[model samples]
Target: MVTNRLWRTLSAFNCSTRRWAPIPLRNTQSQVTQRLSPTSRKIDTLWTQRLSIISWNIDAFSSRPVSRAKLILSHILEGPKSPDILFLQEVTPDVRASLLDDARVRAAFLVTDAEDQTSFEDVPFATMTLLSSARFAFGLDSQKESDGIEGGENFMLGRISRVALPSKYRRDALYVDIIPPTAPGTFFRLINVHLDSLGDTLHYRTHQMEILANVLREPGCSGGVIAGDFNAISPEDDGLVNKNGLVDAWVALHGGADPDGATWGVGVERRNGLGPGRLDKIAMMGLKAKEMEVLRPGPIEVPRPGEEPVEIPWSDHCGLRCTFTI
Candidate 1:
């Protein structure tokens, strides 16, 4: 059986050596508490707890990936308040290594991919989810089971699961069953996905969405949130949410067709004639969006050791951050 102390070892994958290494632990109590700001702490006292999520496609394929990854991590971690969950896509091996090795990241969140790296090794890049350990406890194996296991204050109960979507590109979705602190004996699914890209691969994305929709409607699921890069480049992409019986967090907070809702191709020059579009999104069922914003709106110049500093948007795509209540 996995003990509470065993979870604290926090094993990380070594991309260079292709081995798993134990990440050194720190004073997790202090580190975890420091991540939340005063306002965030106060907000926690309310009867209904809100879930904050940030979904970004870090664009691992972009130039200076290592440097870009560092910058992206800094921006996300150094923010005034940490998000409850993070859904990142286009994460290359090196990027994944950097994230797992960071002490702050290790202390603050439970990574979905850390324990099962081999399942995704065949893919060039994969999507990753970070669940805030401070706020949530994993559910039992069966959603019909009672509230999370009771033991160490920080012990997470069950495990997270992933589904391989039908994609020519081998894309898949990572999901976790989390018991909300305010609501016991019930759990909601949180999914991280990066659908097939490009304008010609619409059918692949459509099929992937259908499969995810069914997962949300599963017998014991209490409703869930799906967030990540949808690559919604076409007009038909708008209908996927409604057709699947899901609510778009962006549209729920701000109205439809809002220019500010655009999340991709911003501050970056595209070879195609297409302008920026809202490709990354947070879609949900049985949850209400209370606040939403575009993360890392502008570009930054990343300094290269010998070469001139290269200017690029945080990623080819801007990130989407939203807060939802159950």
Candidate 2:
């Protein structure tokens, strides 16, 4: 496969970014007092008890990944107001390496890779990456019932299951159990995936969807969240969803809203390499969404004036995150 000269060149530059490490999920949390706020709004416990779920395809952390990490820190993980769970798809081995070695990303998340690294030289492919902050516990197997995660005020990292799919790229769905602070005795099941990207065909994707739907239909999936870059438009995705009774967080919150919001396609159709469609998503079986928004890579204004721009994002797809009321 041919690599993009621009990306190849930019990847060579030394990249660095900072982020908050995972804070352990304690059983108790302060009450949230509000209803709706801005997309970049900090976690306000005064509003109401809610769970923040961020699902992004992330364009394989293409160029200026540090900038993207900063955007995430500023917009999603804002210290005490950070998200409870994070689901990311298309996190390639190189991207994983960047996050592992980068100071910025380490400050924010205690990540659990779905596939364990065997050889140091092996390059991980497109994978469903599951990570977390201080808001929840990690490292245990996903269960249908409440299997209390082991964590204190600061022990949130845990084990994750790598469930594979029947696709040409050998894709997989990652599973992690989380305890949302708001609802007591409830273990939130989080699944992240990147469906077949070989092309717009229903054959392989159909089998993959069947497998995904079955997972969602598991007995212990009441507070389950299934999210990622579905590559779902070609199949209309509804039949499978309806079959499993999963609710689309975007559509549930919007309901014929934001017609122009496209995660993967955006402007690629006019240029016509990928598409102009909404490809990324967050779905759930029993969780309620308080807010959902599509996150894009725009400019971040530096403090000093009359200086060259410090960071620029060139990812092919945009990002999306949703805050759910538990």
For lDDT, the strongest prediction is 1
Can you write out model 1's per-residue Cα lDDT over 202-283, one digit (the tens) per residue? 9988877877776766544567799999989888998898888899999988898789888887766667778889998899
For residues 215-302, could you state the per-residue lDDT of candidate 2 as single tens digits? 5444333346778887767545545555555688777778735675677656444544545667787878656877877777555443
What TM-score against the true fold does each predicted structure earn?
0.79, 0.65
What is the TM-score (0 to 1) of candidate 1? 0.79
Model 1 whole-model lDDT (C-alpha atoms) = 0.69
Off by over 4 Å in 1: 1-47, 138-159, 181-184, 297-308
Candidate 1 residue pairs in backbone clash: none
